[model samples]
Target: MEIDGQPLWVAPSIYVDSKEQGIISLGHRCVLSEHVMLLTHDFSLDRYSEKMGIAPSDMEYETKGKIRIGDYAFIGIRSIIMPGVTIGDGAIVGAGSVVTKSVGDGMVVAGNPARELGTVESAWERNQAQWQLKRRRP
Candidate 1:
């Protein structure tokens, strides 16, 4: 819940962790879709101790890294944002993407491991064409 700026839209089912340092940092104009999980840590069985009566499922594993999303980034539905991920400005994550690494500025990523598909330049081109068509339509 550490939002660094304003005009953010987050879906209801987004799982956000705010306990650790920079666990979730959302810049201005960021959009998080439904069921998107912004995780900071992973629970491991090694943390469990039999003598301490701690169950493996009850072990707590803290975040070794942070999740930072820059301005104007859009995280699609059901996306899993792993720790230590810095998403640059204007980046777009497609639906159900599992982001394991940092995404470059204005890039489009999708699928498991979130491969870079293209850049925002393509989107800008499409937008320009639409505008031209509208102007020509009278």
Candidate 2:
């Protein structure tokens, strides 16, 4: 587990799995909302072990890989970042998203498989417009 800078906000309920042979790196100003899960390992081999009638503790059933959240990345509430996933700088993961692949810089992703929605700049623009509209309402 390596956090690169200050002002990294992580909610209390978030879970970071760093017990495996991989690294979980959170970059500068990264925000992890409540119930966000940063997973560093996969249990795909567990089914194989079950089929072979092998004891769980007798074999290695976990595949580990690094999970990197780049600078200024925002992981929304209840989002799950899978193993070997790298979220680039300024990327945003929408609430309840399950990120299965790498997200590029400034990209906004949402949904179960976390498909790219748009860039961070677009999202910011939309937010600003909404705020301006609200302020104008009399």
Candidate 3:
């Protein structure tokens, strides 16, 4: 489903990690890649129930947050995006990155914690070049 021309790439294997319904609003031209998981739940071991030594099911959990991916955002393959994060317009997430916070517009990021690598425009240009090169081969 799309909202205002934005594309939400919800794959078959992707599940919203929240027991609560996840609300997503994608801006214009946002593209979520395959196998990307949008997370909304965080489990803590601090607060626990005496009986099972586990947190109650209805305990105070921060699970209600909207994930907003801005215009022209490209989430790479197998990336896990946490809740309440707004990926800015034109930001590019490298493949397998775990996004924990908001990304700036036109920025490119990668790694387990998703650090800034470069600009999205630069990455896009490089990717296009690589795709063209591959097309010409064989």
Candidate 4:
């Protein structure tokens, strides 16, 4: 596990599987909320078992790859970041997201498989507008 720079916020409740040989790198100012899971390895027991004509329980096969979270990336609570995923700089992952692929810089992604919703700047602007509206309400 390699964490670079200062002021990175990783919640204590988050689970990071570091037993595999693959590296897990967290960049500057990255924030991992509670219950976030960073997986560096994926089990291939079913596929291996089928190929070998054996029970999945009897098979011990895994695919390992590095997980890199770029600078200023924010992983929301209960999100799962799969192996070999490189979250780009300034990316925003919505809560409970299942990230299966790499996120582009400043992109905002949400839901299972984590599809792109919009850019960070647009989301921020929307948020600001909502805040202003709320302030005007009684």
TM-score of 3: 0.72
lDDT of 2 by residue, 11-125 (tens): 8998987764339888898889999998887888798887887845566677877998999999999999998899999999999999999999999999998999999999988
Give the C-alpha miss distance for residue 121 in model 1, angstroms.
Answer: 1.6
Pairs in steric clash, model 3: none
Clash pairs of candidate 4? none
lDDT of each: 0.82, 0.88, 0.75, 0.87
Stretches > 4 Å off in candidate 2: 20-22, 52-57, 132-138
Candidate closer to the true structure by lDDT (higher is better), 2 or 3: 2
TM-score of 1: 0.75
- The positional error of residue 109 in candidate 1, measured at the CA in angstroms, is 0.4
By summed lDDT, the worst window of 10 consecutive residues in model 3 runs over 129-138
| Native-referenced Cα lDDT, model 3 | 0.75
Please give, for residues 1-138, the per-residue lDDT of candidate 3 as tens digits.
Answer: 226573645446665665543366677867778888887665453344534656565665344467878888888889988877878998988899999989999999999999999897787677775654444322
Model 3 ranges with Cα > 4 A deviation: 8-10, 18-22, 45-60, 124-128, 133-138
TM-score of each: 0.75, 0.84, 0.72, 0.83
Which residue segments of model 4 deviate by more than 4 Å?
Answer: 20-22, 46-59, 131-138
Rank candidates, TM-score, best first.
2, 4, 1, 3
